[model samples]
Target: MLALSAWAAASSRAWAQAPMEPHERDLYEAARREGQVTWYSAQYSADTSEAIGRAFTERYPGVRCSVVRSTSQVAFQRLSQDQRAGVAQCDVFASSNGGHYIQLKRQNRLTQFRPVNADGMLPMLRTADPDNYFQYSSLGIYLLGHNTNMVSDAEAPKSWADVLDPKWKDKLAVGHPGFSGAIGIWALQMRSMFGPDFLRRFERNKPQVGRSSIDPVTMMTAGERAVGVAVPSASTLFAASRGNPLKLIYPTEGVVAVPAPSAIMSNAPNPNAAKLFMEFNTGPALSRITRTMFSESLRPDVPPPEGCRPLDQVTLLSPSLEDADRGVPELREQWRDIFGV
Candidate 1:
């Protein structure tokens, strides 16, 4: 055991000191001088985001990662506030909404950067932004999840429309599109698949709505809710691994695959550190960190998380860039009207 521990420590050191490409080295040197990067992130849970931050610091010793985690809309709102105040506090902006990137790019709020590691991502994810204003830094599947202690597998929701059944009234937990960017997209997709009146129908169920996509997972874990509507698969599986009574249900309507994009701010307080962080976001270190958390790995060389179905194996529903750009805001307004929150 002692020898094994030593070997593992040695391997970690070797990996940390591994050769960097010319671009990475240049950025690292400048980033070290900058000392820290502030990341406004809505891509993962707070704990997961902090873990990624710690790993990034471990990989690039002289630089520090400062993480500010919130729901997508909240994070974006904070960034907007900063912009209005003429403060360049955020270095990198990571959001679950692709539509946010579209708007930011249009406003010239994002720096045009193409990470060298971006080329290492899966081909589909690689082309997320042809203009190089943002890159897909994280991926998650949104689906139904349930507390095993409260709901049997046979009794769980098997389709997106299943949660709307009168039987699930007061027993369902869902994220609010007005707060969560991923939920905004999910709401838009649900509308596309069902109809414009989908939220009106769902509202009748009296489901508990939370601000972030991960909130439904928490409700299920506490047995406060029997089912989660449009919850993130990664956090659900990670909760299950920790002995929570959670189980994912890939709805018959197809799972919504959310690609979270991260971009450097046009007025980054630490531009070099921000660029370095962007590269790290798509690199092997982040992939390895997220894989154990049951999140999808963007890199082809990394295997799918232990409990996740590989992207290719699952039927995925994704909003087009244009659809998301137009639909998310519309859905947010509709959500506010229907949920009244």
Candidate 2:
């Protein structure tokens, strides 16, 4: 009886609220009344991300947004575990793991609401889900990092192949494929290009895998690993700003990009707040946040971030999700067998 009554009330309001921009105007007013939303995010730093959060709360004064940060892989694991245990504490998820989000979309655990700001995205960043279940970030959202004293300017691995060189034997730091979607695609791309020998060839370099996805950067930053696979754009830019001698290797084979999407949970306690938050994040604020973080904005026509090369100029890897999904189980087996993890 209660559920039916609630549905009737919501439908009646939705009807009365139907304007050309009903998605936003209705969401905004409804959100102010609900007042709170929870987000599970995986970000390398709290400051910049939190700045986004703080700015959001300020922007939507009555709508409170709380973010729980975690590593992307770990965050996904938590979400999965929580869901199975019937402890759905998270209201939304914002992360750079497209493959995982794709799996979630398959399960229909997500709400489908097209963002009012979808028109702002670049052609490449757009998702099939016109609703905001997922959205891709700009090119090389993660970057290559190397120890200054070890890899020289001209000697560094300009392309992904350079990392396979035996010179860096056991000296290279690679991200754990499961934890790092950036590396997961890199791994898939490696196999996609090189066949079964790729991991064995990579092994000759004796790449050390990080615990979390960002471990490679941590290793490179400490000079523990001479050459590393990926670093958050924030860390790369901050290091570059200080003239850290670290280089951003815009892949000669083209930078790979994946969706760092935000999704609203189906059973969200604060659906109104969640909707408002998503709209706020996906709009002008996302453009500003991404631009500030040195990421290519999803808004396609927007220019590349400062100190970044244009995506068109570099070689890119177009991953087939269908292929990626098929390969994941086998890929994980291959990684374990080869890496002996």
Candidate 3:
């Protein structure tokens, strides 16, 4: 009986001693010594990016998170310039364009590191970057929006086609596909769903075209526009949560799902910090922050914010990775011709 008890104790100790994933202490220790992580993120508004950076720093305590927020194209342009100059200022890159990862991976610009947390993410999100050079960090949805003070619930636009009514003419706002990556994807999806003549007709509404996805929500909040085209759901959620008169319409045709991707630079100045930041970006910590902004989390475990619908429950007009790569550029030129932007 004593020998049997000794064997049982030995087996339990061996099982407990088996090697496991890297501990948070190891990551934090290396990240602490590295000091900071610079993030060039075009995933959300500048303020949102800053808030997330603050949260990351607060969680890690010793490491700093420096955020350079801009539209996805602008962010990518700056990162490209940094690469050309051979200066590694950005530790992580977050862009709204999923195709950017494919381009970066092909160019050997991305450092591959698959986060263990990624295994817990939704299957579709995990496949966003097959090469593991980047990960699907968030979902940016293009939703129809209206001012509750100006448009009644019954009168609010329910579909992309509904925005074309003469009633909404001069009372609509839209983002320019040329300036915003999310808008570019939206333009492509709209073209595919509504046919080529759609935007031409939508143009007659005389939408107040702005350069950012948040423009429509801004217009709606101020009661300047009764309805908005291509308004980001995140902006609408934030506005509604603040008791603003903004409301989102996830068109019956489906809200456009723009998958944002994040990656570490191959020559990151602080690789350890970059890896840790990547884990945090996909982990529950940042997901909670993003949830408030209306961006859908990739993790199944991260519940949607109060009064917000889960991604699985919502009808999303999601384009495959290949379609986005092939269609976005083509749609951009078409958008310019129709919107004359």
Which is the leading candidate under lDDT? 1
Candidate 3 is scored at a TM of 0.89
For model 1, state the Cα shift of residue 285 in Å. 1.2
lDDT of 1 by residue, 52-104 (tens): 88778887998999999898899999999998998889999999998999999
Compose the digit string of candidate 2's lDDT tens values, residues 161-224: 7777788797888777666555666678777776779888998778888755567766777778
Model 2, C-alpha of 213: deviation from truth (Å): 3.7
Scored by CA lDDT, what does every candidate get?
Answer: 0.88, 0.66, 0.79
If scored against the real structure, what TM-score would every candidate get? 0.95, 0.85, 0.89
- Model 2 segments beyond 4 Å from truth? 1-25, 43-45, 130-133, 137-143, 232-234, 300-302
lDDT, model 1: 0.88
Query: In model 3, where do residues sit more than 4 Å from their true spots?
Result: 1-21
10 residues in a row with least lDDT, candidate 3: 11-20
Error of 1 at 185 (Å): 0.4
Alpha carbon deviation, residue 71, candidate 1 (Å): 1.0
Question: Model 3: which residue pairs collide?
Answer: none
**Which lDDT value does model 2 have at 29?**
83
